[model samples]
Target: MNLFGYEIRRKSNNTASNLPASTLSYIGVPPVFQGSTETVGTIDTRGKAGQAKAYALCSPLMSVISKKCAAIKNLRLAATTEDGEDLERPDAVRTMSHPNGVQGIADFVAHIEAMTQIFGKAYIVRMESVGLPEAFELFVVPNLCVTENAAISPALSFMPDADIVDYTVTICGSSMKIAKEDMFIVRDASYDLNACGGNISRMVSLQKPVNTFVASYEAVHELMINRGMLAIISLTSGSGDIIRDARLPETESEKNNIQQAFRKYGIRADQFKYAITSMNAAVSPVSSTITDLGLTDVQKACKKEIADIYQVPSVLLDVEGSTYANAKEAKTILYNDAIIPEANNIFSVLNRIYGFEDFKVMPYYDHLELFQESKREQAAGMTNLVNALNNAVSGGLMTTEQAKTELLKYIV
Candidate 1:
């Protein structure tokens, strides 16, 4: 079903406190670099631009990174006991399934998409009434809520009397001013001293690699355009000579006649040729032999660098020469190294917010077919261990209870 049929507004009737922006003066955070919006992919030979422009310029870089993040977002989530045992989800967690036909996971994924797009900084403002947060809305921080082309002041205002924060500042174009308990923020924590906490977007570490990747592609495109434009070299008897026809014109009046001569005669037609001669000038067209740019090698290296940042293998990005076996191995590495770790990071923050002491929420993907091989290997290893324990018990090396006790370690 299409959810974009009409405008969706928050159902909460909470009003923004008529607080002044000056009250939140001390609560400051560094904003993302906001120069004029630029495009990197456009035909420009200048050096690599900033992160925002790189995203606009490099298609593959954006695809691979966003795809990885989205994969994490779409992974199935489950509530589990502290012991890592799956449990029935509580009503509080199940609040994601709104009666308004919006899926909680979908809304959450949308925010995550924004987060990954902007160096992994995402703010989710939860709307609450009577001390319970009911709904969530995402806002782009440091990038929006502009005043006179400059980013607005702090979006967060503190209310000491209520002991809760008032998030009543406009973000981007959204005007939200909910209580502190109702809002939850997640950031990548760049560790900049100027920014509040270590949550500022990492200026150097995050963007440098991405810039290199973008620059590599931009260089390749520029080279291709240069090759196309300078392919033909004109050799003339005199400097004043100009070749001016679909085939070479006899007079200066035919200067504008240059067009697609190859279409009229055909490519490499030695028998169908034209000659140009004048009182003191003659002209000949020579196709320059352009050297190969080794673009394939450069692209592979750039792609590998990108995969390294995401902890994913180049094979998963469909890097050339990847075999099926290596791709599968790469997928395993990606799941264990990148996706699961990211899932843990996301769930850890959420679990802290949910304040579940005895239980924790986690993304569960044991059901995914891609991970089945790992599970199968684990199961087989466990079965072998159990059999060995059984043999030990039968051989009187250990008692049945002792074997059971030993097996519990492996099971847990």
Candidate 2:
């Protein structure tokens, strides 16, 4: 099958028996290894979208970041003048409220944010009617049925410097080509020059922390499954030789007796307790306590690193010592540093696609509590400034023009 301009062949059950000599030579399979049952792993050449999606699904920290970034759903689209005054929503912009008939704008933005966070790029096909876009369809990333081709005609390119000509999207065995002009792409930074500098996925750069988180999660899972065992019990003779025959209970009666003894003398519900084993068994700790292992510490560190990469605050992920003040501050930082910037980036591309001549489409966040708090603070500050300016002018300490200039400084 052709994937990202490469043909990948699947190994059949018969292997060498079904293949011709020329085909085997072309694949560079050695004669001795051709029929061998050893299976070789194949690398995914398209990108790390699959791996990133898997990480986002399995890793709790990654999932938190994904959900936090999905706050883009809170943003409302509006048409705004150059001076930042809100204008009436345009007919074309209103279509975004229900991008497709199946989902509302909240769900649409959530999916877009999640995809952009995981895959570093998102494709939205503009379904048009009479040279105007009526709806948009979001394509799933890392889809095997999707293929992006380079522009065939220089004059017909979507963007002057963009190389992508069109996207071939196949769904449910049906395929269609979406031209560049009809597709809106939101992408992250890329360092490569090929294929319009293929987007650099955030998850690709977070492999280290994500792996650390996975390893820690697995370790905790195993510990839980083993009932938090910290030591290994072994039957040994006085001379330090292991008594293999006595290591395990021989009968059901013996097993019950051992369990009874442990319950009676071993660590129990009592706060202070000791184990008095009648048998000559040695207790050697094969693993340390969770504290000694620093499992929580390592996992917390990994979580913080992952959150930082996604521009999410650790406090928002329920980190310890999260005060009300700090949590509110973190929310402000989240909107300012992450969510709003991401929305701006996405809508910047959308504005161009919608091609509105009078006003541009932008994200409105004034309804958000964080922004509301900002407005309240501004109002309080402005009131105090006006009162002070009036007092100064009435007291003859400053002229009216000077006071007006001071007020302008504050307002502007």
Candidate 3:
């Protein structure tokens, strides 16, 4: 017997009465009681699955965000000294190595980037904790553990009014339960305090724009096909009058022969004009003519909308009106505004897990030398300040030390 689309009873062996009392009670339980304490987690990944597929196949914007964010450098563990100075620790770097083969920081960043891009949040699980100063490996798990993987049990030791405080995660299709301390979670922006994990994807609010881009892309291809057809050939009547055939083809063979003839000489006027002339119709030469669809500008607009969704400069996508100098400025802005924040958010999670107070993962784009031009301009301004300070010192208006102090204000 089937109940609610599930087999509740099968022959004499598997029946509802044979199941546990707890399992039987779940059949009529309200959705609110499905999880503990009335707080529910968002576990459904269908949206994320669609987003991932789109990122993989339909668009390059997600990849651009992920790859650019993952290209961080100079991230290392550091320790704070008694003098309040931060010192990089090489020993700490080696501890970051994964015991599950050769995966390292790069692989970690790639997984994180992809997770954040598709799901808007990520969780790094520590694989083991067996030694002093605990050398452990980190791996990512699905974001929806509370809903998709395990049930939440209320920690009864808490006061009645206190929140659930902690959760134990269990893998589906398994019997083991994971301790709370083994997981480190980071979430994107959310208004709900009780939300298990929240994410704010760049494309989340740009659904309309994404649809427009896709539609415009398809429309452009269709327009191109029509344009190609019009460019290669033309079809016209001897007169702009409709031909009415009183006696149509009575057999399939006759119809096919007529179709073959039309396919051969119907499109090009030069091929069969004499044959039409031999009939009672006067032949007029017809050729393809260009029609303006203004599709180029429309497609450009659509591309710009897509770039805007990711805060990426359209020039990076080969959009027009983007100069080299402006593109350079855009690249700097892109790295500073969008990419760095994401890298910082991921690092925050790592810091919390490793209990590091002095170190952080920072996005490094200095190899691009984005600040060099600004530095040059600053140097020029500083030179003028120095020359003026020198004149003041030479005129005895200010002492050398005083001039130095005045110069330091602007230079520093």
Candidate 4:
């Protein structure tokens, strides 16, 4: 049964269990649980499903949440860890071995290790959907006032006002997909979508740097008057935590308090515009690495486009020709060294935003260089390493029993 539009029973068992206004939506991590633990891990991607199965386990709370959510359908609940585990078990978190990349193995292990450290035995629901669909997608009537030009209206009346190419860019999110426009205020050169999609084009388009412009404070609020922007936000180098801490209440009165707080923190609307501009320009620094990509340049005009992209900042870029005396000096410019300065500033605003860490860059580069120094070493050690893994699993570093069970997932 599709079972769409059916609301699950709430804890209070109210006849109409609409989600609480405070219901935290999932964004990799559910909002209700606030603390996060960041760790380095090795995911076991040798077998395809190994990675997927384990990543969810790393931040195990969601699994618990999913399990509790499944209780409505009477589905069997059977999920655990290296040791006998349960939603209430304290030692639920365990560290996974470290290696890098999104391979079924390395990525999987990293997540497992993260969950072990951060969410060790925290309150969480569990789910079992070996057979049935886990979550339901329902179509409900729109929530809104009957407005004019319902269809043509921009997805969001007030885009989370942001900076694109230095010129204030409105980031309007919409349930209805709309064509995106970009501007290059730096070179006064804007380009529209090339109508192609690939990692190659994602990188090739940015052969030349696009200069982004910054907008004025007055322009930010004035643009909101008519533009159908989705969210009104201040995107900036400032941390996410700082932005989320806004005391703006749901009512207009709250806005005054929020304004005071904004002013107190020097987060005037112009500064908010500055943040978006920083984010737009930030893409170039991210792209300087071997693999970099981002939004199209302006010329196309209009401020509405949406995208989520990542880069492999030229890891250890410019490290050459430096006189290094020791490993400490070498590490000072490694992936962590190269990316963290800018990255930490990006997430410091928020509690712990993912995708800012070093490992997130591994997926875009040549994998073997990750552990070894040269291509020759990678070629020389690959077979032996794979054999070593198999032997170790057969031996006891992990276990033949474990590999036998997990590796079965990748067998075609």
Highest lDDT scorer: 2
Local lDDT at 17 for model 2: 68
Query: What RMSD, rounded to one decimal, does every model reach?
Result: 11.9, 8.1, 12.4, 28.4
Please tell me which model should have the higher lDDT, number 1 or number 4: 1
lDDT of 4 by residue, 154-238 (tens): 3433322122112211122222311112110010011123311100111122211111101111122223332233334443344
Candidate-wise lDDT, in order: 0.52, 0.65, 0.54, 0.26
- Which parts of model 3 have CA positions greater than 4 angstroms off? 1-46, 70-88, 93-101, 129-133, 142-177, 189-198, 215-239, 243-302, 358-361, 379-384, 410-412
Candidate 4 Cα RMSD after full superposition onto the native fold (Å): 28.4
TM-scores for every candidate against the unseen true structure: 0.64, 0.74, 0.61, 0.17
**Model 2 C-alpha lDDT per residue in residues 1-412, reported as the tens digit of each score:** 7555456689687876676755543112223223333322121223654454445444654566566656778877787787878788767567656656687767776676766776667777777545545544543334344577865665533342366668787665567887767666677543345444456566665666665565555555444444345566666655555555335777999989777766654334662356666677776665444576587987788778778878888888775579899988988888888888888877777677656667787887779887887899999999999999999999999999999998998775
Best by TM-score: 2
lDDT at 27, model 1: 9
Candidate 2 deviant stretches above 4 angstroms: 1-46, 90-93, 129-145, 151-161, 189-198, 226-256, 259-280, 286-289
User: Native-vs-model 2 lDDT?
Assistant: 0.65
Ranking by lDDT: 2, 3, 1, 4
- Let me know the TM-score candidate 2 reaches against the reference structure: 0.74
